[model samples]
Every structure is written in C-alpha cells, then in structure tokens.
Target chain A: MPKTAFQRVFPYLLVLPTFVFVALFTLYPVTRTVTDSLYKPARRAADPSVFVFLENYADLFDSTHYLGARFVQILGNTFAFTLATVVFSVPLAFLFALLLNRQLRGTGFLRFAIFYPALLPLIGAASIWAFFYSDTIGLFNTILRGFGLTGVNWLGDPNVVLYAIVLLNIWKQSSYCMIFYLAGLQNIPRDIYEAAQLDGAGWFYQLRYMTVPLLRRTTLFVVLITVTYSFQTVEQLQVLNQGNPADRGNLLLYFIFQSIGERRNWGYVNAMTVVLVLLLLAFTLTNFLLFERRDDDKA
Target chain B: MLQRSLRMLCLLLVASLLAVTPFVQAQAQVVVDFYYPTAVDGPITQTIQEYATKFEAMHPNIKINPVYTGSYTQTRDTIRTELAAQDVIVDVAVMLATDLTSFVEEETIVPAQQFIDRMENGEAFVANFFEAFLANCRDEEGTIWSVPFQRSTPILYYNADLFRAEGVEVPRNVNELIEVAQKLHTPERAGLLMPVAGGFPIWLYQSFAAGFGQPLIEADPAKVYFNSDASLAAVEFLTKLGMPTSEGGFGVGPMGGSVWGDTPTAFTSGQAAMIYHTTGSLTNILRNATFEVGVAFLPSGLPNENGEGYAAPTGGGNLYIFAATEPEVQEAAWLWVEFLASDEVQSDWGARTGYVAATRGAWEIDPLKTLVEEKPQYLVARNQLAHAYKEFDSYRSIDVQLIINNALSSIISGNVPLSQAKATLDAAQAQIDSLLAEYR
Candidate 1:
C-alpha cells in the first residue's frame, strides 16, 4: 500500500523528541555508569583513569574492610525496608480504600486526613518526624513519660532506628497507595458485591474471594510502584539518619550517596548503581511475568 | 538613494557602538565567582551579598558574584562536582579548612602564599591571623593554600543558672568535668551533651585526643594515630560519659551520642546542663537562653606536662582560590578574599554571626570588642585559641573520617563492647592505612 510521504515523516517527527530525551537522559547515563563501573577513577583530574574491568564489582563484595562489610548489611537493609514498606503499606492502603469506599459519616474528612502525610515533602516530613523522635525532648518521649512509661530512643538507637524509619515510610506511603486503590475500588462495579451479598457470602468470604481478586491488577500496579519507591529511599535517610546509629538505617541509595559525596569513588559508586539497576530490573521483570501469566490464565 | 544610504550609515554607526561597548566593558571587567556556605543561622546569605556589594562598589571594574552554597559539606561537594565535570565555575570558595589536603592533592587550588608574597605587607598579613586558625591552611612543607575566614573551635557551653544553683564551680579539667557532670545529673536533665553523633564525630573527638596528648593528624597528611594510647584514652573517656553507671560508665548524656544541631537547643532549654559545641553557637545560645550562659574551654581529661588541661580542635571554612581560574581572575578572587578577611569585615561578621574572628586584629576592633565588653562570652573562644589544635585532616580524609566515625559511633552506642573498643579502633586504623597506602 502506498503511504503519503508526510504520514511516514510525521510519525518519525512525533517519536523524535521522546527518543532524543530518552537517549540523552536514561540511555546515556546508564551506559556511562556501566562504563564507569568497569574502570578505576583517577585520584586527581590530571591523572588518567585506569581500566579495572570487574575489579570494582569484586571490591564491592570481596573486601571486608571499607564499604564491603557494610554492603551486605546495606543490601539486607534495602530489601527489608522495601519488603516492610510494601507489606504494611499495601494492606493498610487497601483497608483505607475499602473504608473510604463505604458511604459513611466524615468520609471526606477521613480521606483528607489519610492523605495528609503524602502532601508534605519528604525532607519536611523527616524534619517533623525528627522532632517527634528526639530522645530527650521529642514529642514521642514526652508522651511516653506522661503515661509513666520509659521513653524509647526512636532515631538514635541502632536496634529501633530502622523500624522508626519504616513507620515514617508506612505513614507517608500507605496513603499514596490508597489513592490508587480508591480508583481501583471505583472501577469495580458495586453490583457484584451486592450479588455476592444475596448469595449469603460472609464479608470476609467476599473480601477474600471477590474484592481481593477484583483488585489484583490494582494491587500489582501499586506493589510495583511502591517497591520502586522503597528502593529509592535516600532523602529521608539524609534528613533523619544519614546512615547513622551505627549504619543500622543505611540503605543502598544512601550508601551510594556517601560513596560519591564522602569518598569521591566514582567507580565504586557506579558499580553500586549497576547492582541497584539490576535489582530493580529483576523485580520489574518478575512483576511483568506475573501480569502476563494472569492474562494468559484469563485467556 | 543618497538619503537612504545616509540613513543606513547612521544605523550601522549605532549598531557598532552598541556592539563595541560590551567588548570594552569586558576588557575592563574581571568577574570573580565567590562560593561560600552558611553552616550557622541568621541572614548569612544577605550578609555575604552585602559584603560583595561593598567590595564591588570599591572596585567597579571587578564584579563579585557571591553564591550561597547550602552547607560546608554541600559547598565542597559542589566544588568537587564542578572540578570533576571540568567546568570549574567557582573561582573562589569558602570550603572546609580540612579540605586543604584534598585540594592540594588534586592540584585544584592555588596556594595563598603566591598572592601573599606579592603583597607589600605579606608577612604581617599572614601573621595577623590567630596561629590556631592558620593551622589548617598549611601543608607539610608549610605552604599556605587558604586564608582563614569563618574559623571556629568547640567550646563547652554550660547553663550558668544550673551551675550556680548546684553551687559548683565550672570544670577546668576532664576529671573535674566528669565529677561536675555526675553531680548535676538528674532523671530529667542530662549533665552533659557532646554533639558527636552520626557520620562526623571526629571533630569533637579530636579535642579529646589532643587533651590525652596525641593529636589525630599532624602536618604529615599520610599518617594518623587512630589506635594510639592517647586516642584510646580519649575514646574511653567519651564512652564512659554516655554509658550507664551499672555498665561502668558515667551515665551523663544519651547512650549513643547527642546530635550536633540539637546540642545548643538542649543547653538553652535546660535539657542539658552542659554541652560541647562550636563557638559559632555562642550568639544563638545567648540570644535564646533565658538563663545566663557560660562559655569555657573544652576540658581534656588529663593535664598536659605544661599543666594545661584545655584542648580544642579548630574548625569552619577557609577562603580558597582555585587554580583553574585565569591569573587576573585569581587576583580578583584574592582581593575579594582579603576584603572578607579584613579586620573590619571579620569583626563585623564575628559580632553578627558568633564565629570567632580569624585575625587578632578583628578581636581588637570596635564591634567585636564592644560586644565582648558587654557579653564577654565572645572572648572565651578567642582566649581558648591558645589551646586549640588543627582539625583532623589528611589525604583521603573523608574516607578515613568515615571509618573512624563509624567505629566511634558503634563504640559509643555500645554495639562494640568496651573490652573490644581498642580492637575496633585497630580495625579502623587498618582500613585508613589501606586507604592512604597510595600516598605512603
């Protein structure tokens, strides 16, 4: 079939801007990071960078001193943080969505209240939380003392710091995921629930068999977004912990930040970035596969 | 046709005038980009801009572009990023004085000696600054690479009201500090707060090491005494302060460590009876505290053979001109540096911002002198300069600092057993040794 020349040219023009942007930002940086990971950066600008091949990667895992020993801990912290965020936030968000979906008194007010934490900037939220988490004069300790209970060192104790940060993340993130779940809830026709009610299905039974399955797509989407968001947690760490209290709260991203800012080891930092990128890619691929399998089952 | 051609000639003449004026202006103008960080509170950006405006007014041909970079750490990072990108946008900057070694190693900065030598009263100009403030500006060979600007040292800030009510004298030595702190300790208020928490405990910890008779870094940037006996005593003293009494500790402050930013607030609010904080916080503390505030030198636990028990590490920023700049631009930048470090400006800055003026001349000047007469807290930091040492700095400093800081935080937080504290330091020393292996 003969196509008009303008039609073909117009399509290329339409794609050009996006392609150029992706090439400049995403593709270029990723390629540069990969190349940088393979070489040892020069100590000084005048010195030439040495090609170290996979030595940077080996250094990351093999060397026990320096950042190597902490790498495992940081990797564990990253996974734990992401898992906890996803696990707690998804369920809490689902509960909020279900409650908000109900026709009840003060639903509008409740919706606003739940979403308030999400509205605050991460740094601002971290600052407020720092005040709340202060050991001597913080709001949390004061309240605990009022109840004749001993105060907890929320941000300072190595044991409790990660969970303290997790709580902040859950507080900020659950509401965000709830918005997605709310839209998902809206998309589900209410008549199906009514039909289930007519069949004498208990609330729990319907929730398990009906509401849960219906929201699978939304849950998967929310989980994917939340997981990626969890992996990129740096600002809160910067403001609240700075990978401190014995690096208990140090996550992968903050570790990368320290590597660059403190050590100026671009090669090591790039290697860390490469590992992080691979981790995210694997998670995304797994999610995609899950989604594809579900579609196949339906087909 | 003749009239049209005449009009065109006039237009061409006007266009040429407009084009040539900027070129002439460019020929006469040398623009210097001055980057500074505001580590303390108040209208710092405005104050810096005001100084730049005053300087520009005096030298109309040289334009001063004053950029308020976020914090000292941020300013260093920004400069490093620019250097790595080969942009070198900053002509002169107020970077951490401890960054001198790093800058020298990278060959990114021109030594201030070159410019000072060119000055008529260069020797006196260098001598005008307090010796402690100049400690961080020189390398092993004693080449001056920076000019001291916003210099400070840690001092003990105590609640005078609490000390008076308790009927106790101010602690002058480490042993007395422990005794006084323990006596003032209560369930509600901590006796002492040392703001040596998180990633950078080495600054305040240096005072402890120096008091114990072993400084962390000397002029030799290749070496540090992280595992020295004096270093061990310093850490032990610091650890005992925060440890519970049952655990063979002084049980004074929080178990891990008090935060840097919260230290002044704690003292001012009476949550802490005493705190080790930067002299930069003096004005802020005086402004906020309802009770009388007393400033004293940091008491090193043991007295030196000279019978001096006080020790502190000097900190804060120094003005550095980068090497990448044009010679004329570097000269212009040096002029801006001198203008900022001038006695008049230094005195005004010290009085306004609570930073101890780098030069003794600034101390003898009007505003600072009068402020000292009225409050007298400002003089304590300057008086303590006699006991101050160079801050911990070396080749690969940030990396070495991280190792030491992590170890100290772990030890202080009780993650490392007191029995194993020495072992932890040894491991840190090993890491630092490897890090500085290239230099050696």
Candidate 2:
C-alpha cells in the first residue's frame, strides 16, 4: 500500500498549530525554569542577570538552616499524603464501581452519588472541609467532644495536619476515580462473570480473579492519573491550611508557591520547580517500569 | 451553491474581524486600572470603589478602575508580575509601608512627592500633609514614592467590664500592663490578647523596640537589630505574656479574628480581657459592641526612663502611582489623591471608615472632631501619631515577621521553651541577615 505525500503531510499540518502552541507555552517555560535554577538570587535590583552556575542547587544542600531539611520534610509529606490518598481512594473507588455494576435497585442513583464529589470545584470542597476542620466551631471536633473525647486540632496539630489534608484530598478525588473504574467495569465482558459463576465461583472469587485481572490496565491508568494529580494538588493546601501550623503540611508545589508568590524569590522558586518536575518524572518512570514488568510477567 | 457558501464565509469572516477590531484599537479614554489591597475590612472594597467612581465622575476623560487585590503582599506580587510581563500597567496601587521600600528599590513605582511638586497644587499639597505621615511615605533617599492614605498605630483596647470585674487599674506602662494582665487573666475565660499573625506581631515588636529606645534596623536597611539585647528583651517580654502555662509564663491564649472584625468581637464577647490592636478596629467596636470599651496608650517600656510611655509604629496604607503610567493618567491620579486628601473628603473618609485622616485638617472638622471627642479611641489613635515610628525598611520584613510569629506561636502553644524560642529567633534573624547580605 502506497501512501500519498499529501495524506502523510495533512495530519502533521493539522496538528502543527497545537504543537507550536504547546512548545511556546509549556516547553519554553519549563526550559526557562531549568535554566533559571542555575542562577543565584540576584544581589541588587540594578545588577545584571548574571548566571551563577549551580549556586541555587548548592544552597538547597546547605545544612546551616533547615531549608534542605524542610525541603525533604515537605517532599516526604507530599509522598505520604499522595500514597495514603491512593491507597484509600483506589480501593474505595473499586468497591463503589463494583457495587454500582451489580444489577440492583437505584443503581443509577448510586452511580450519581458516587460521582457527585468529582463535580465539586477543588477549592470549594477544600473550603467546606476547612470549616469542618476548624477547631472552635467544627462538626468533627464537636462530634468528638460529644463523645466525651478531647477535641483534636485537626489542621493546627503538626502531627495530624498532613492526614487531615490527605483526608480532604481523598474525599474530593475518589469519586472521580470511581467514574473511571465504573466505566472500566462496564467494558469488562459480562460472559466472563457468568462463566465464573457457573464454574462454582462466588462473587468474591470472580472479582478476585477474572474482574481484577481484566481491570489491570484500568487500575494502572487510575493510579498514574491519581499520582500525577496528587503532585499538582495545590488548591487544598492553599485554601485549607495554607501550609500552616508551622509549614508542616507544605507540599513541594505549595513551597514553590510560597517562594515565588510570598517571598518573590523567583530564581529560587524556579529551582524548586525544576526539582518538582524531576521528582514527578521519577514517579512516572517508576510507575511505567513497575506496570510494564507486571504486564510482561502476566504474558 | 458555491456563491451562497462564499457569501456565508464572507459574513463569518466579517463577524470575526469585528469581534477582534476593538481589541486592536487604542482605547479612546486613558483607562487607568488601579489594584488596591483592602487595608481594613471587607466592605472597604466598596468604599474604595465609591472613591474610584467619584474620581471617574470628576474626570470623565480618564476612566479609573479599582481592582480589590487581596492582601498587601499579594498586591505587591501581582503588581510586580504585571509589570514584568509588560501587561496592562497597574496605574496605581495602595501598597503597605513595608512594601513601598521594596517597590521603590525595584523601581516599580514613581516618586509621588516629585510628581506632586511638579503639579500645580504642589506647594499646597506639601503644606497639607502631616510631617510624620510624610516622613514614613519617603524612600531611603527621601524620595516620596507613595502618599499616605489609610494610616494607623497600635493602641491599647481594654475591656472596661473586665477592669471593673477584676478591680484592676488600667496599665499605663509595660510593668503595669504585666501586673494588670496577671491580675485580670482568668483561665478558661478572658486574658490579654495580641495577634501574632500576619503583620500585627511586627507592629507590636517594632513598637516595643521603639519604646525601649532601640533602633529597629541599621541605617543601611540591610541589617536587622532583632538579636540586640533590647530587642531580645522585648521578645522575651512579649513571649512571657503570650506563653502558655506549660512554658512557664502567664497562660494567656491566642484569640482569632480578622484584624478589623475579630478583635472587637473578642473584647465584647469577654473572650479577651485586653486587646492590643490598631485603632482602625475602633469603628467595628463602636458599631458592634455593647460592652463599655476603654481606650488607652500602648503600654510604655519602663517607668522613669527616656523611653516614651507609649510608642506606636506608623501603620497604614499608601497610594503609589506606577512608573509606567502616562502623564495624563498620572495627572488624573494626582487629582484624585489630592481630592482624597482634601479636608471634606478626608474627614468624610475618616468618619465613614475608622481610619485617621492623613492631614491635620481632618481633625479640625467640627463633626469629625466631635466624633473623636465622643469616642476617645479615635483621639488616642490621633494622639499616638506623634510617637508612631515607621515599620522596619527591608525586603525581608514580612518574612521575618512570619518566622517570629511562628516562633511566638510555638512558645504560646507550649511546644517550645521561651529560651529556645529566643534562640530560634536569633537564628531566624541570622538567616534574614544572610538573605539581606545575599540580596545586597
């Protein structure tokens, strides 16, 4: 089969504008961020933009102050938060999807209930959760007090604020993940389940073997999306705790925000942005490698 | 069919071109968009818009748009980014005093005093402003980069009911304040309150430093004197008052409120026995409180000392004209600023919002004078202006405040010892010094 030159060029031409736009808006800024990471903080407003190669990176490793330690602490917080969110959210989403896939009454309404939180704007959900986390006047603490238990400062305590944020993140994002799982469940062959049932398999066995094996791709997709989304989850941190209670809940992105927005140290902020991009890239690569090995083993 | 399709395409192209043409055209009127941070409360945005409307009405030639940017720090960043991108120039901004130093250093704003001097109302304008107000508005080189708009200094706000209930005298000095706070503090009830959030703690600390006869920062403005003996003593004193019982100080607790909205509520609700806040909170108190409120000078450093009985830092908002604005737009802005400073407007603005007028003539107005006389707190703010000092001039003042506030919070929350807190503050100061040196 011979392809015409025009036919091959037509597709590339059609996508050329989009490619250019992405290059200008996304790739250029990212490259500039990486370049800026090599420079030191500009000494004076009048000083020429001199490149201080690797100085900013060196400062990140210095132990005189807690900047380096703080960076690691925030990174750990982000990883812990994201891991906990995925662990809770992925399983719950699968459960909801499985329940919704069943031939039951009000399944349509149940699907709607499962997907409702996905429709909420992130900051609006964060705001509502912030009110619930409020110490003096909050529903959660009030319930705790009613049970004759001492109220915990949900967002104020350094020990618990990360978990509180993770709780909020899971609450907002699980419904979204459930939608994907539900769609995946619908795509699975009904004949497989029916054959499993006829083979003396119960619902649990069917779900454990046939359904779970068939949903591996979907599960991989969900994990990748949720992990990336977690890295970029700035709104909840911004609106709820604002990385407060002594910056204990600060994520990498939130630290970047504080550096650029609050401190106006764009150079250092750009350096932090470079670090974040590398971190996310590493996570993505690890996910791909792990999933690819699993696929190979199954084959 | 081809002719009909061509006609349809022509019509679509014309519609699209019409939609794009206005964006290409240079607007007829000089539209000056001003981004202003709300200095006090929320509704003040409406008041600022009203002022913008009046300015627009007076000068139909120039359209003035006032955007309610968030906090002062937010406004600074927004303006800086806008300028860096060479986007729509923020023709004017209401910047904080602490922010003006950085903006001036960055060459983001024009010197308003020179611009004012170049204007027709130059001499009259220079004559009208208060000396202290004018001094605080100037840059390091004495160039006035902003005009004082809404100004305030910290004043003592006491609960009259609590004073009567505890049978304690009002504190006129720091020693007396400590004594009275000790006597008045009741656990699970009311105690003394100082806001350690945002810029409030810096104001309190700077005021205390000034009262202790200590310089806040060095003359170069690149160094901090925070770790000095007097400053450390002041921090120790403040930490002692705010520290919880577990930390070996009076167990006074932190109170929550928007600077303008919550302090009055805390006092009137009897959740706080005494509040150290700006007199700007006076209007909220007058409007909302049913409790009898007593106003007094901020407690002085020590008795029989050269330090004044009360010292206040210049706390206020300043209006800055952008360097990139057109001359005509600057003229329109000058006219509006002058109008705002006029006796009638200043008095009205003072009467409406609890801000003290930037000019002395605002106090001379009979109605404004009577209002101040009726509410002595307004008079206290006005009288405190003489003792008021400008906040520290440094690019890192806000960051320093955040560190100090967090350190103070740790002390107050019983998470850290006062000695450890002081050491942490000194380390924080050292970090700031390094930042200053790096920037320098």
Best by lDDT: 1
Candidate 2: tens digits of C-alpha lDDT, residues A13-43: 9999999999999999999889877765443
**Root-mean-square deviation per candidate:** 2.8, 5.5
Model 1: per-residue Cα lDDT over B1-440, one tens digit each: 99999999999999999999998977698999988898888998889889988999998889999888898778888998898888989999999999989889889999999999999999999999999989999999899999999988889999898899889998888878888999999888899998766568888888888788888887789998999998988888888888889989999998887877777888888899999998888888999999999988787557433546567899999999999999999989999999999999999999999888999899888899899999988898999899889888899888888888888888877777789999999988988898888998
Residues A123-240 of candidate 1: C-alpha lDDT, one tens digit per residue:
9999999899888788999999899887787877788889999999999999899999999889989898899899999999998998898889899999999999999999898888
**Candidate 2 CA-lDDT value:** 0.72
- lDDT of residue A297 for candidate 1: 93
> Which parts of model 1 have CA positions greater than 4 angstroms off?
A4-7, A262-264, B1-27, B303-307
**Interface RMS for model 2:** 4.5
The prediction achieving the highest DockQ against the true structure is 1
